[model samples]
Target: MEHPALHQAMLKSTFYPGEAGPVEFHETHISRLYLTHDHVYKLKKPVNFQFLDFTTLEKRHFYCNEELRLNQRLCSDTYLDVLEIRQDGDSFHLGAGSGEIIDYLLRMKRLPEGRMLSNLLTAADPTLPGEMERLGRHLAYWHRTQPPVGGDENADLERTRRNWDENLRQSAPLVENLLTADAQNRMREEVEHFLTEQAPLLRKRQSTGQVIDGHGDLHAEHICLTDPIRIYDCIEFNERFRLADRLADLAFLLMDLDYRGRRDLSAGVLQAYDETWGTDLDAPRLLRFYKSYRAWVRGKVLGFLAQDPEADAATRTDALARGRRYFSLALGYLCRRPSLILTCGLMGTGKSVLAAELATALGAIHLRSDELRKELAGLSPSSRDLSAFGEGLYHREATERTYRALADRAELHLAAGRTVIVDASFAEKGRRDDFRDLARRQQRPLAILWLNCPDELLLERLRQRRGDASDGRPELLAAQKRIFQPPCGESRVLPVDTRDEVAYNVQRIICHLANPEFLKEQP
Candidate 1:
């Protein structure tokens, strides 16, 4: 296939030493790479996208050298050298041939196919968790050894802000089509607020040597899970991209893990990094700011690929899907705080189901009072010895202890940097108020989801229920109805009808959670 005016003949096995086979080709927005048996050669496309320019022969030559130099910092054994594609009368040869230089190529030893972290993750490899932890430690060592990038602090902050500005500008075309307009607006406002409020932290990091030259395009795809686990293909075209607060570099990988739905891996990586440095410094604001920005940048990059004219329809469709995911992730990062979601309703209203669903959707920790109460009473989760209200484990004093334990468990989860959902009937107003006080004391956002259903439907569901953690029965529904203090006049309370279609209910809940007002404190 002809690529960048290079014909198939130019990729003959004879062009390089110890290489044989038809070349494997890969193309990105700015470069085309050919992977031979032993080595890979990357050729810059002669296109000047405003952020990067490789249009001229000299510019390509410079970027090729720059790429070779920069990538060697992390994968020294992989990046070999930059070679010129010399031209003869009718053919092109790699390396120093007696012909005019037509183009330049960055040459490197080819990594094993399907060995990248991304591939392994996609294949659901069982060993990835340990490998990811090692990767985090590796990054920590690299950051510790590398000298920090020094320059004007104010200018650096502005440069970081411009990255977000550029992302919003590039993603504008996707509004109302690939991404929702409301999401875009909310993200923009939240990002701006974060950058402004956290400016001091950014400056402090720079002043304290926390800003370092680091791998800019750090994601699973660029990481080879070999013995040494080489991470290659750093940002070589722009120094500004490569030089930033070390946390920003780390956030890129975290964002990738989040995008891949690997919250466990992400947590492991962060924990390992913190342990390696022996620091318990809390940087949630910085983490969220950078993660949101990185996700948006990923979306913008995918959008560019989707819009590329040369991509096939199938490829474009896949890019669009991936782009939407990244944008959604960005929005999620924007709104994600260590918050509490209380699923409040009488029995058979599906509060537990809704809580579980929401927790899975947001990767939040789901805490069920039934399970907690059983565990507290030294009973198995499945063991059900039904007792009347105000007797045995259901006694007033025991129930109060159970609620306190639940709130304590929720707080622990929140402290560990996770959103939490507490599933309980919350029949008593005092219990609900206790949770509200807990949230206020912690300064954590709280949303109460009150489930509603017709009494007949509730009875029907209770009758059909086979196995559940809850002990509610039709006999107790009357007492629950009498004592249940449904959420009222609370701005953070979102009342949803469990009798409605599941999809509709889920959508409404998601929309409510995404609303900034829902995250605010209620009057």
Candidate 2:
């Protein structure tokens, strides 16, 4: 900033190599980026933070080379080299030409601006879902090839403890200013309990190479949807953040998508990722656990930006609001008290669809009665034996037994401080009453989302519902309608029309969860 002549020379196209039209300068919280016609140069700021040190020229050069090497693994064509800036008496040069070496710049080929993941997401492109599938497969193979750094279970667990402790310690000062004490308490308590209870499982993952070197910052802005998806800007100064559980990596992207209000894409991406790799990484509430961590990290960084002395007043104010938003997102992923959400209606009212969508949005456990009933009856979930209405596996006794098991699983998860969403056809009053009693005894809040549809729509849906876990048929609708005892006077019931968009319905459900009295209605 002091060298006005050097800065002016760098801005002109003449300073760059081979016909660069003009140079565009951009700055982030830690780095300065200069974009030429076909190439880009990045210079790290000489700033020392608690997590990273780039205060010395030597340290900056080391990290520049490190960034080049690490990023080349995923975006080989983009990362060219770490070039040196040299200086003479009263002038500075871009390349390794003469005089004394002043600084280092990570040079790269400029990628297409249109292909950036963040831009495409904002445009609401339909092809993004297929791109995400490809990206997931790419990440799966990339994950397999990563070098495992010290794959000792004990060491990994202890390191995890220290990392979490450091996060809590650093963010403690902004308890009331950035986030509420209740939100912080929930995060600290749930994280500790999860780490302690699932220590063996987590350590097993470490022993196997599921925990390895990963892209520390997997934000959408760092990804490009090229012929092969390119992910760049991995943390090079700190292996402590880069080396982590693979789920934590996925959690970063998932949390980023959620923060951007693209949970639909996040859900699809997870499905593809899980299908390509295994689902061993998906523990109960584990994604949310890691997601909360990722969101908190973003919030903490934003807090730093807000307090930066060099930042403008407008920039600081924007950072403060965005930081609080990130903290709120983190809080949404945690539960101070577990909740029991039941989805009950006739068979064809879109209960399963809503349940899955809601669970993905809230990171809650989704239990479907159809699957559980088949599991109990020792039948394949896809096997559809439409025995006479209310007979066979759908018999009164068998149905009650399945509901009891469903309730049992819900109770287990709720007891462990996790929210549960149970999808079932609560046509009989006794089953509904049983759940109400369970909620009462557990001392947890309850909400029965009673899905409703027109008779013709319900019949049409039942007729067209094929290859599903449900054995319901159009003929069974009349029987169900007759037996269905609507939650007419129940204070815990909320009627939901199943014809809405999943995203809108998810937001409605989230709002309802935050304030139960927001939209109470009898079914």
Best by TM-score: 1
> What is the TM-score (0 to 1) of candidate 2?
0.67
Q: Cα lDDT of model 1 overall?
A: 0.80
Ten residues in sequence with the least summed lDDT for candidate 1: 1-10
- Tens-digit lDDT track for model 2 on 1-523? 2345656777877877685586899977678888898988888888888889888899999999999999999999999998888789877777867779878889899999899999999999999988888877778778878877675687667777788888878777766666656556656776788799878877887887778789989989999999878899999989889888888888899899888877778877787778778776444457777888898898888887888889999999888877766776676675434678898898889999888767754667899999999999899999887688889888889987998899899989888877789899887677888887887777678888989878888888888887999998987778778878998877787888878644345545655665534323222
Superposed by TM-score, candidate 1 places the C-alpha of residue 197 at a distance from the truth, in angstroms, of 1.8
The digit string of per-residue lDDT tens for model 1 on 205-249 reads 778888888989999989998888799999988887878888889
In model 1, which regions exceed 4 Å deviation? Answer: 1-5, 280-282, 342-361, 366-417, 421-517
Residue-level lDDT for 490 in candidate 1: 58
Candidate 2 colliding pairs: none
- Error (Å) of candidate 1 at residue 220 is 0.5
TM-scores for all candidates: the values are: 0.74, 0.67
